[model samples]
Target: MKLLLVDDEPVALRFLSGVLAGRARTETAPDGASAVAAFARALDQGEPFDAVILDIMMPGMDGIEAARRIRALERGRGREGACRLLMLSCLDDAEHQIISQYDAGADGYLTKPVDSADLLAALANLDLPENPLDGAE
Candidate 1:
């Protein structure tokens, strides 16, 4: 699967990469603004990721806003809706932001520090083995 893993911390990024060691197409972003820009570039190149694992809190343009902007761009590009945004935050109070994230247009949420098995399970479910049209399906 094509995955974009976004976080401000290098250690977290490295940890995620290690956890997703077998998932070869994963990309990393250091902050929300760059994440949005990268997402846009991928769409422009006609090769967007299957999922985006985003950190909720960042220095600028937090993940929520980035997801919202990406959704707007998706609509402009004639895409049906925003891509699947999976929260990869360390926030214990994740439930408090569910409504806001949904409103901002996230498809799913996961808390950190991530458990490899759970992360893989969620990704596997999102990327169905029986379906090849996952990215656009």
Candidate 2:
């Protein structure tokens, strides 16, 4: 799958990249503004991401606002809901933001220190084709 992974923390980005290694083609952004620009560029290039995993807390814009803008961009391009969005937050209180995340266009929400299994499971539930962990029993 074509995926965009956004996080301000280098370690978190690397960890996520490692987890999805070989399972997807991923592009990384260090902050929300860059993420939005990349998303727009991908759409313009006719190669929009299939999914975007965004960290909710960032230096600027924040993932929630970024998601709102992404949704608007998709609508502007007549491709609303074409990309699935998953939100991540280091905040333990993030559970309270779940409803807001959904309202902003998130397909899923995962707390920080996210496990590889949980991430994969969430993606699987999104109906992504051939989830690598799907039959790993």
Candidate 3:
């Protein structure tokens, strides 16, 4: 799978990338605008990501707005079976936040300080293909 990981924190981004490295090919963005640009470029290249792991609290365009724009872009392109969006946030998993995430087109949500198990579980919940590296060392 091809994945896009977006986060403002270098440490968090590195950790997440390390965790997912064997499982998927990943590209990253440090903030929301870059995330959107990368997404568009992937689409243009005809090699769109299978999923986008977006951080919620980035400066400027937040994950919510980025998700909305991504969904809009997919719609504009008439893209069916578009990439899944999973939101990562340090914020509490409050009802309103969850609802807003879904409303903005997130397929799943996970709280920060994420573990590999939880991250894998979240990805499993999406309509993704089986990971080839599932049992690799």
Candidate 4:
């Protein structure tokens, strides 16, 4: 899978990328703006991400807003099914937040300090191809 991993903190971004390195083609964006830009560029390149793991809190634009915009962009391109979005936050797994994320177009949610197994499971739950590398071959 081609994954976009977005987070403002350097450590979290590095950790997520490290965990996903050999399993998928992963890209990183340090903030919401860059993430949005990267998402657009990927679409333009005809190699859009299969999933986006976006942090909920950021300086300019939060993950919710970014998710909304990304969805809009996908809709505009008529490629709404092209990607799955997973919102990440440090907030408790409250019902409201999960509801809000779904409203904003997130396909899944994961609280911060994410468990590796859970993260992988969440991706699996999206029903993506079992072997991303299969596409290349």
Candidate 5:
């Protein structure tokens, strides 16, 4: 799958990239604004991402806002819900989870320090094509 991973922290971005190393073709963004720009560019190029993994906290244009914009972009193109969004956050509270789903239109939410197993499982559960990560170690 083609994936966009957005995280403000360099370490976190690297870790996630490593985790999904061979499983997906990934593009990384340091912040929400860059992520949104990349998303737009990809769509314009006819190479939109299959999924986006967004970090909740950032300096500007947080994940929630980015997600809203992405949804808007998709709707504008008549391609709403075509991209699966997964929220990765340090906030594991119920409120955050609710906001990520209902407010930000995310397909899934996972807490920080996530392992490859949980990440893959979350992605798999998003109604994507059959278990691509199955037996991946």
Candidate 6:
């Protein structure tokens, strides 16, 4: 599994990268623009990941818009969208309001300061029928 992680904080990036070491092939983007660009690069490079971990708040487009664009790409590809999205947010009750309001194309929403075990569990649960917007294979 290749992971495209988009976060603005260097510390958060380091922590996540370290924890994800044995789980998947991890690639990162520090902001929204790079997230989209990196997504394209991964597709073009023929090394698309199984999932994406995106930060909800960031400079230049934010995670919602980026996800929308990725959905568009998935549509254009004429197949089930492959990359599951895990949204990371700092907003209170983010899973309810913040994620509910936006069609950010996420497989799941996780609040900030997430633990390592929870993160791994989220990834493991990505295969659930209700989770993968595009039905899992």
Cα lDDT listed for each candidate: 0.75, 0.87, 0.84, 0.83, 0.91, 0.76
Q: Name the runs in model 1 displaced over 4 angstroms.
A: 128-137
lDDT of 6 by residue, 110-136 (tens): 788988777877777788333322221
Candidate 4 residues lying further than 4 Å off, grouped into runs, are 93-96, 130-137
Q: TM-score order of candidates, best first?
A: 5, 2, 3, 4, 6, 1
My TM-score estimates for the predictions, one after another, are 0.84, 0.90, 0.90, 0.89, 0.94, 0.84
- Model 5 CA deviation exceeding 4 Å by range: 129-131, 134-137
lDDT computed for candidate 3: 0.84
**For residues 10-123, what per-residue lDDT tens digits would candidate 4 score against the true structure?**
999989988787988999998888999999999999999988999989889888888888898899999986788888888876773766466788888888889777787777
- Model 3: residue 124 alpha-carbon error in angstroms: 1.7
Ten-residue segment with the worst summed lDDT in candidate 5? 128-137
Q: Over all chains combined, what TM-score does candidate 4 have? A: 0.89
| Per-residue C-alpha lDDT of model 5 across residues 45-119, encoded as one tens digit per residue | 999988999999999999999999999999999999999999999898999999999998999999988988898
Evaluated against the true structure, the overall lDDT of model 4 is 0.83
Instruction: Report the lDDT of model 4 for residue 34.
Output: 91
lDDT of 3 at 113: 83
Residue-wise C-alpha lDDT for candidate 3, range 23-130, written one tens digit per residue = 899999998899999999999999988989999889999888888888888888888448889999888757736664667888888888898788887886787765
- Candidate 6, position 106, lDDT: 80
Full ranking by lDDT: 5, 2, 3, 4, 6, 1
lDDT of 6 at 58: 89
All candidates: CA RMSD (Å): 4.0, 1.9, 2.2, 3.5, 1.5, 4.8
* Colliding pairs, model 1: none
